[model samples]
Target: MRQPVTLSSRGFARAMRADATKAETLLWQALRNRQLNGLKFKRQVPLDGYILDFVCFEAGLIIEVDGSQHADSQADVVRDRHFEEQGFHILRFWNDEVEKNPDAVCSAILQAAKGRG
Candidate 1:
């Protein structure tokens, strides 16, 4: 069974959307409005008590743009496992990777989405 989205979680997601990081903002521009192969993507979405960086429900894909703090994170491992168990494929990218090469990031995302579809 899926967990209910709590009010706090919704509020947190909203806040995250409002205070997006520089890398996130750039990626959002690339992914928003079905820009990438007409695939719809939502940012700062709340799912099963977690705030996802980007999600395409139709493709069952989740994209996470992480900072240096997420390096070797056990929490991320558990989170990725949970998402995988839920039948979602996750693609993680570093902030620098996104910032430096946005087109490459978008290409990767498109490739992943197509593979999932």
Candidate 2:
């Protein structure tokens, strides 16, 4: 029998959250506990077959922190199209930027949330 979708997604999300990268951990601090404009963000959220780094449902915003490995990826273009079709705005930041300037990253997230709020 096939497992329920929610169970698999939740399990995967939990694993991803636990194994978060340094940049993900740094950014999560600012996003968690409603520190940014009282908006709640979920990490390692599974959506449409992709696991998003961070997502705020209220704002329909998805934040993706890309490492050097993501440079010029065509898969990203396809993924972006999927998100756009779903009416979610994606905000991407370099992993190094998230590590070095978390505050600025939070600020950008806040702005995006406000725009949708």
Candidate 3:
């Protein structure tokens, strides 16, 4: 069953209170520039009853930084399916991948943005 898409701006504020890792912090810098393929993106954007790590509405993209707990494939697949049904393309990066190779992560996000055009 698919849940309704819902979001509240207040949710983002709460999430921001938590400590952000280097990856999330770094990615936020680039995404905030609104220069990714010329499409504006919002950091910690709220959508579909969730607060996304990053979102490019123009591209219908959601960037998620997954910690080790995300190793569970079933949950990931289910989440992806929900977003996919809403015409969103979900991009997931392991926490280490973002912390260690942020540039590459940005590149992938850029590439995904390109796909939206």
Candidate 4:
């Protein structure tokens, strides 16, 4: 079973959800409601001081919608390593990709979750 989230992390997650990006909002619409392969996904989930854009716990997957700020980001490298160390598989997509090609994004997500499913 997963550990309970700290109050601070929970609060931060809530804030992130409220302040979600356009790409995040777009992806969330498709990922929510089990619209993708009957898999459940959570948005703005907090983990180890980081808020993931979308996470499917059952699949041990983390989906990141990256904006311009994330281009060549060292912080992201570190963050990815940390999550990978904890057995989470991450899939990153550009903001424009999510907005312009949602179907492809969904397809990639579905492919990644295939192993888990």
Best by TM-score: 1
- Clashes, model 1: 0
Runs in model 2 lying further than 4 Å from the true structure: 1-7
Ranking by TM-score: 1, 4, 2, 3
- Which runs of model 3 end up more than 4 angstroms from their true locations? 1-9
Highest lDDT against the true fold, candidate:
1
Q: Whole-model lDDT for model 4 versus the true structure?
A: 0.93
TM-scores of all models? 0.97, 0.90, 0.80, 0.92
Q: List the residue pairs that clash in candidate 4.
A: none
lDDT: worst 10-residue window of model 3: 1-10
Tell how far residue 103 is off in model 1, in angstroms.
0.7
Cα deviation of 52 in candidate 2 (Å)?
Answer: 0.6
| C-alpha RMSD of candidate 2 | 3.2
Q: Candidate 4's residue-wise lDDT over 9-81, tens digit each?
A: 9998999899999999999999999999999999998877788999999999999999899999999999999
Give the per-residue lDDT of model 3 (tens digit) for 1-117: 434545446555456736677778877766677755577877765555566777788888889988888797797788788888998899999988988888898899888878685
Question: 1-117 in candidate 2: lDDT tens per residue?
Answer: 223458788899899899999999999888898888888888998777778999988899999999998999999989989887888899999999999988888888888778796
lDDT of 1: 0.95
**Tens digits of per-residue lDDT for model 1 on 1-117?**
689999999999999999999999999999999999989999999998889999999999999999999999999999999999999999999999999999999989988998676
lDDT of 3: 0.76
